[model samples]
Each structure stands twice: as C-alpha cells, then as structure tokens.
Target: MKALFDTIKIYPKLIITFLIVLTPLFTLSLVMNKYGSASVKSEITNSMLSKVHFYNSTLENEFGRTIAIMREFARYDDLDLLSNRTEIMNYYEQRGAIRNLQKELSVIKNSSTYIQEASVHIPSIDRTISDDNFGTIQQDEFDALNVLTNHFESPFIYWQDRLFISLPYPIKSNRQPPDFVVDIEISIPLLKNALLQFTNHTAGNTMLVHFEDGWRIGGDEPEGFLQAINSVIQADNADNAELHSATVDGQKYLIAFEKSKTLGTTLIMYERESTVLGPLDRYTVWFWMISILTLIVIMIVSYSVYRLIHRPLRTLVRAFRKVEHGNLSVAFDYRGRDEFQYLYTQFNAMVQRLQQMIQEVYEQKFRVQHAELKQLQSQINPHFLYNSLFILYRLAKKSRDENQIRFSKYLSDYFQFITRNSSDTVTLAEEVQHAKNYVEIQKMRFASQIEVAFGELPASYVDLTVPRLIIQPLLENAYKYGLEEKETGAKLTVQFAEDQADLLIRVEDNGELADEELIANLRRKLDVQDAGLETTGILNVHRRLQLQFGAEYGLVIAQGESGGFSVTIRLPRTTSM
Candidate 1:
C-alpha cells in the first residue's frame, strides 16, 4: 500500500487521504442518524401505546357502568313485578301495563348519557315496551335475541346498520324458565367518540375490531390494513401493550393493539411511517448537505496545502537537479518565513561555499602547474655549478695539490648526474645515487671535519620510485645545520627502513644543538601547508612528500640514538609518482 501510494501524485494522494478519513465520519453520522430515528420512533410508539391503553381502560369502565345499570334494572323489584302482570291482564287490554313499562325504561334511559334505548319483553303477550320512539324490534334482532344468553352481556352487534352493546336478563318469579327478558342497549357511537377524543392530537388512526363478527369501528381502514390486523391477531399479542411495525400497501406503520376481554373488541393504534419519520427524513437531507459542504471545504484545504508545500518542494528539487548536473552556482529564490525558506537560504549558502572552494582548488592547481613549469625553465643545476666551480677554482689555486685531478673527476661526474632533469620522480636507486654525488661533493668540503655514513638498502627497495631532490635536501640540511661547524667526531648517518605501510629515511647528525627549539619549530612548520614563509629546502621536501603521499607521510624531528638531532622522512611504501 505504501508503494502504491508513493506512485501517486501528491494531489491525488491527499484526496485519497481525505476520503479515507471521511469514510469513518460518514459511517458514524449515518449510524447515529439511524439510531436517533429509531429511538424517537420507540418513544413515540410507547407514548401511543400508553394512550391506547388509557382509552381502552376508559371504554372498559364506561361499558362496566352500563352493565352495572343493566344489572340494577334487572334486579329491581318494581321491574320484576311486571313478570306476574300477564296473569291478571287480558292480552288485548293491558295498555296500562305497557304504559308502566315505557315509563320505567324512560327513567332508566335518562339516568346516563351512554344509554340509547331501554326495553322489556313479555313472552306471554308477545310484546316489547321500549324508551325508543320506534318502540319496535327488527326481525334480525329478534331472531338474534333468541340465541343470546338470558342473564349476561352480549358481544357488540349490528342492528339497523349501527353497532350496539346488548345486556339481556331473564325474569323468573316462580322457578319457571323465564317469564320475561329485559334488554338494555347502549349506543356504540358514544364509544367511538370517546376513542376519537383521545386521538385528537395524534398523528395516526385509532380503531376497535370486533373479534366475533370481524367488524371494525372508530376509523376508516387503509389499503392492506386488514392484513396488518390479521397479523396482530395471529400473533395472539392483543393483550400486549407493546408496539409493532408493519408495512401496509408499501407504506410502513407502527401498530399497537389491546384486546378488551369484556367487550370482545381489540383497540388498535397505528401511525404511518412517513408521518412519524418526517423529522428524520429532513435531518438526513440536511446532514447530506452539510457533509457535501464539509467535503468541499476539505478539498479546498487540501489544494491549499499542496500549493504551500509541493510548490516549494518542487523548487528545491529543481535546484538540486541543477546542482547534480554540476551547476554549483545554482541557488533558490524563495523568501518566505516558513521552514522551507530557511532551508532555501541554507542551500544558497552551501552552493556559494561549494563554488568558492571549487574555484580555490582550480586556482591552486593552476599555480602549482605554473610554478613547476617556471622552475623547469629556470633549472640550471646551480648546486652542481657552485660546487664544481668552487672545487675547480680551489684546485687551480693549489696546482700542486695531491687530490687535484681526483676532485676534478668527481666534480665532473657530479655535474654529469645533476644536470639531467628528465623527470620529476626517479627510482630510489637513482635518488640514492644523486644523494651519493652530493655527499661526494660535500666530503670534499668537510672531508676531515665530519664522518658520513650511508646505510645499505635492499635491491628490491632500491627500484621503488620517489620524488627527486628529496633525500639530498635532508642531507644538505643535516650537514649545514648540525655537522658543518663541528671540527671532529661529527657524524652524519643516512638510513632507510620500511615502517608498516610506509617507508622511513632517517638522516642523523651527532652535533651539539645551540638551540633545540629551532628543530622543534621547524618540525611544527612541516605539519602545515602554505606556512606563508620562504620555502627552505627541508620544508620544500616535507611539502612534496605530503603532496605526493598525503598528510600522514611527512617529516618529523627527534633525538637520534647517538644524542644528536635526527630528521625522519616518512613516505608511503607505494606512491603514484
């Protein structure tokens, strides 16, 4: 995944990161929204269920009171006296008995608001007296009456296209089966009105279902409403006050129902999903709008960040690219206050320093080549000329000298060796021979004053290449500073040995030091290049050793084993020269 992301450009990468970060927030928002809606729905369902239960109890109590009134009228002694009146009155002329029955029902009807009519039946006279102005019974109600319980309340019944609650009580005077039946009718519209009052402020419908006849009261049913009712009934959850969810006609609803045991009706309260979830729908739309706006803002922020960081980064890359191609003069032009600006300033400084260093190196190289060419052009072997002229002049003045011819031959041989300037470097054997010729010339000058020793070197080491004039300068320094003033017993030794990866050539002189600090100071000067003084032969030899080999191979001064000053020349065992 990291490699895949690395291949992507910064803009897309930032966009993808925003998406990765936003996914969880979007998910959380959706989850909380759904949870909030469900919570609200549950609360509203519980509230509606509570109201349904309250209304159910109210209906139960109202019907209970109606039953109680029916029971009271059935047990009244004055009303029961009508059961024996048929034996005293002729069937055609009992108008006074009928009037008394009507007066009694009228008094019962006026007692409560629920009662729609009241009536008493005489089987012997085949007559019924009622408080209703019609004072008659339809054939279907009469036929249904025969099948009802004589001393109990009946289920809700339809009569004349209107629902009614009937309570029938059989009157018995002498242990006979029944002399007459008393029926009390309470209007169902009053019950519907009571249900409607409870739901005036609610968002849904309230209803009562008659279990015996599948009749519904209190509200118009929507499409598939009957199916939803059937599902509730099948679940046998009519006694439960808990709310249920159902979809009716492709529209969702919350349904809560309760059964009335006394009335054989189930009270159902239902709310459509759209109505109950209206606020949630709006909230969802608003949330989406906010999420879109937030995404837009985040995108803007991402673009801004890319410009702030990426453009500067690209500039750095381009500057480095120029430097990589050897354009050391390249520099950044940024002048902002952020960290990148600091980096740009530092980068510019570094480039300037690098350019200066490179130019110094080039100029130093040019100076070195120019000096070497000039030295080559002016080379005339002055040491050989001075020594040869001195020896020739001294011999000419002393013509009778015994060593005159020998010295002349030696000087001729020395000039023959010294005058050749074929290469800047030569074999160790050649350098040793050149030093031997210089020593031969110096011996003529200080023959009896000092003793000079040249140590033996291996033939394999003799062929190694080394800088010319390197050994002769140290020999000259030893003779000039440490041995020239000594009258006798002054010794100069030139010895060669390999020291690990380096080769050492020690030139020793057993001479008293007037100032030991002088040697120490000279050794210190050899350690630094461009010491800013006229280059002595020894100092020139030390610088050449380092320039050819490195800083580690140079010259150092120490006391020799013979209690005299020793100059040690260190050089690598292998050299490019």
Candidate 2:
C-alpha cells in the first residue's frame, strides 16, 4: 500500500495524461477518415452530373441547327409568296406557279441532305385525270405531311427502308371547287448524320423497318427491303390510318422513337448506342481517375497532418514528463532545424536549472518554510563544481573500487573549465573530449547501465572553436530523461560530423517520449520555478546558447525507430559569437 501510494505520488499526472491524449487522438483519426471519404464521393457525383448535362446540350444543338436551316429555306421570298397566296383557287392554270414549285424543289434537292425529291403542293390538276386526297392512296403519308403544315413545322427526317417525312402544302382546284391538299414525301438521310455529329459517333444503318413497304424515306432502292422498326408506330382504325409496317424482307431494328407535332405520327431514328457513346466514353475513364486522385489527396493530407501536428505534440508531451520528474537534462531531439529545436533547448535548460536549484536547497524538501518570514540565503550554481563532484560521488558509491581515483581526474578537468572561461572557442576536438568526460562520469555513476557509442571525430576538424559545455549538457540530457527509464542498459550514440559550414551533434537513446500533459505541466512549472519540483535544464542551455552563439543552434527532440528518442544540435563550424 505504501509503495503504490509513493508511485502514485511520483507519476499521478502522467497516468491521467496518457489516458486523455490517446483517446482523443483515436477519435480525431476516425472522424477525419469518415468525412474525407464522403468528400471524395461528392466530387465523383458532381462530375457525373456534368457529363449528363453535356450530353443533353449536344443533342439540343443538333436539333437547333437543323430547325434553323429549315426556317432559312422556308423564308425565301419566292417560295413564301407562292405558298401564302390566298387568291389561287386552282394551280394547274398558273404556269408561273408550276415553274416556281419546280425551282424550289431543285434548290431543296441540291442543297439539303438525304432529300431525294422536293415539290410544292398543287390543288388543281385536271390535266392528269388522276387525283389523290389526304386519305386516298397513302393516308399515312398525307397525315404526316399535315403535321408539318399545322403544328411546329417539326418535319421528321426519315432514313433507311421505312422512314420518310409527310410535308403538306396547299394545292388549288381548277373550275370545280376551292382548296386542295397535296402531300410531299422526301428522303431524310443527311439530317440523321447531322444529329449524330454531336455525339461524336457515326449513325450506322439508319432506317425505318417495315414488313411490305421497306425502309420508307431513306436508304438505297425503292422500298425494296423491309423489317420491323420497333419504334415506328403503325395503326389503322376508324378515325385514322398510317402506313403500317410493310413486309418486303425480314429483319428487326430497335430504332429511336420521336413524335411528330404536326402529323401525329412516329418518326423512327435508327442508330446503335455504341455508335453514339463511343468517343465520349473516354470521359468515363477520366472520371475514374479523378475519383482515385481525390482519395490519394485525402490520404496524403491526413498523414502529413498526423506527422506535423499530432506526432510532434505527443512527443513533446512525453518529453515534458521526463523533465517534470526532475530529469532537467532531458533529451529533446528532432530532425531539421525548426521552431521545436528552440523549444527543446528552452525546455532542457529550464529543467536542468530547476534540478540544480533543488539540489542546492536539498534541505528545503524535508525542511520547514515560513509563509511570512524571509530568509537571506546565498545562491550557489552547483553546475560549476557539483556537476563534476556529483558524477564522482555517484561513481564512488556505485563501483566502490577505483571510483575515487577516476572521479578525482574528472574533477580536476571540471575545475580547469570552471575557472578559465577564457577561450570561448574550442576545437571540435576539445568539444568532443569535453562531451566524452560528461558521458564517462555518467557511465561510471550508472555503472555499465548506459551504453555510449561515439562516432569518430577527425583530428583536423578538432581546432574548431565551440561554445564550452555545449555537447556535455546535451549528453547529460540524454542520460537524464531518455536513458534513465532503461530496464537494463540504455544505448547512447553520439556523432560529431561537419558539413560544408556547420557541425552537427546528435545524441540518441532507446526510450519512448514522456506523457504530453506532463511536458506541458512541467513547462508551466519551470516558468513559475515551482519550488524544487520542476526541472529546467533545457532553459539553461537555451539561454546559454543564445548568450554564446546567436539565437540559432539549439536542442531538438524526435521519436526515432521503435519509439526511441533522439536529440540533435547544430553548431556552425565558424560561429561568429
């Protein structure tokens, strides 16, 4: 019971923080993924709607163009005058009328497509001795023509075996009576091609299939072939009768169906679906690509955000806890020189200074404090001597053999650096050696519990001057926070390398980051200098680096492989300060 209470007293906030942060992160990940998938689906749907609109627009354009051409031909001054004449009761007596009709037919036959014949209606024709009214010979043809004259002038373009338009014009009767109606049938193949043009595909074998009559308005031969056009409406009842399906040959066509506004008959347009949607089918492929691209973008953005914000914050929190637990010299490692590097430096220094103060006032922890009484106490910086002595003391107690002798030598070098703050610039060699001393003392204290690996430092690069104790404090941090949690032996790797103009020092350990909430709490405590409870070694390094080298080079923390952490510090080879 006492041991559990003490453990709780030690890491109460840490337990709470781990539960809080982990749960929220998992929730955030799920929400983002769900919405991200919805966004991709919406984008794909919008693209499909656009394609539908495109198809409709194309069909409308083809119809509009054909209507315009028909209107243009109808508006000719001569044709209009002949057709609009109310005074002409009969037309066979008028030579001028016949000539005008002949001329209009010539123009339509030559200018229009699939137009085999074109002629004007004549009411009176006594010279021929033969007459055919609306329902006499071909009632369906006459009715289809009546549609063009009455309704929308929406003439159906007929193609293939049983397709043709019924165009009705007023014909005149001679000495007998008044008005007469003549039905004009014309071929309509060119118009089919024009409509198909919008789809970017060809109209193949466009024709009306019928049993006896054959392909009516368009196609080769004179109604020789026949088939059933599924869409071509054919009927004969008491009130109406159309040229029903004619049987000349046998074959079936699933033709396109269109209604005539004027004649009340069905105009069948035959063409295959593949022929219409083939070229534009590539758009479907592009649509698929767009969907795939959106998914990739969402995945990438989610991953990047996780790395930039979530991962870093969590790492700092864990690091902060180590510093919280009196690990003032905690390692704060990161890759690339960013704002976090500065943060790492501040955190480590603050914690270390806080720990040193705790040591200086070790009596305060178990001793008394008065709320009203003020006591004058001398402040001492134990970092100068105690750092050396603390290492030796711990080593002497741990090894019990040569601890006193090894620590004595470390203490002498420590004083030499303490008294002589003269040479601000030390060779890379000197910095490397100084860092070695710090690590060796810790190695002795921990007693084979921390494994230290040093990268080879070139002799020629040793003459470079560096801020004293730079690498030592960083190494101290790795031991303080990262390696302290090791079960058996913690591995510490130090590398001293120079690029074109900068020296890089890296310290790594096989320890996971501390709890995030603890890091934040400790940082707050450091700023407040919350008695001897908070660590602030990172703050000390931050200030010292700024005081010695500009405001750039400093500590940074990173969660490396297997959740281990690393600390990196960059120092310019020729730092002016």
- The best candidate in terms of TM-score: 1
Q: Put down candidate 1 lDDT per residue, 71-94, tens digits, no spaces.
A: 776676545555656566575545
In model 1, which regions exceed 4 Å deviation?
A: 1-28, 86-114, 124-127, 132-140, 150-154, 171-177, 198-203, 222-224, 308-577
| Cα RMSDs, all models | 28.6, 23.3
What lDDT does candidate 1 reach at residue 413? 64
Clash count, predicted structure 2: 62
Candidates' TM-scores? 0.46, 0.29
Which structure among the candidates has the greatest lDDT? 1
lDDT of 1: 0.72
Q: Name the weakest run of 10 consecutive residues (lDDT summed) in model 2.
A: 370-379
Q: C-alpha displacement of 57 in model 2, angstroms?
A: 73
- How displaced is residue 509 in candidate 2, in Å? 1.8
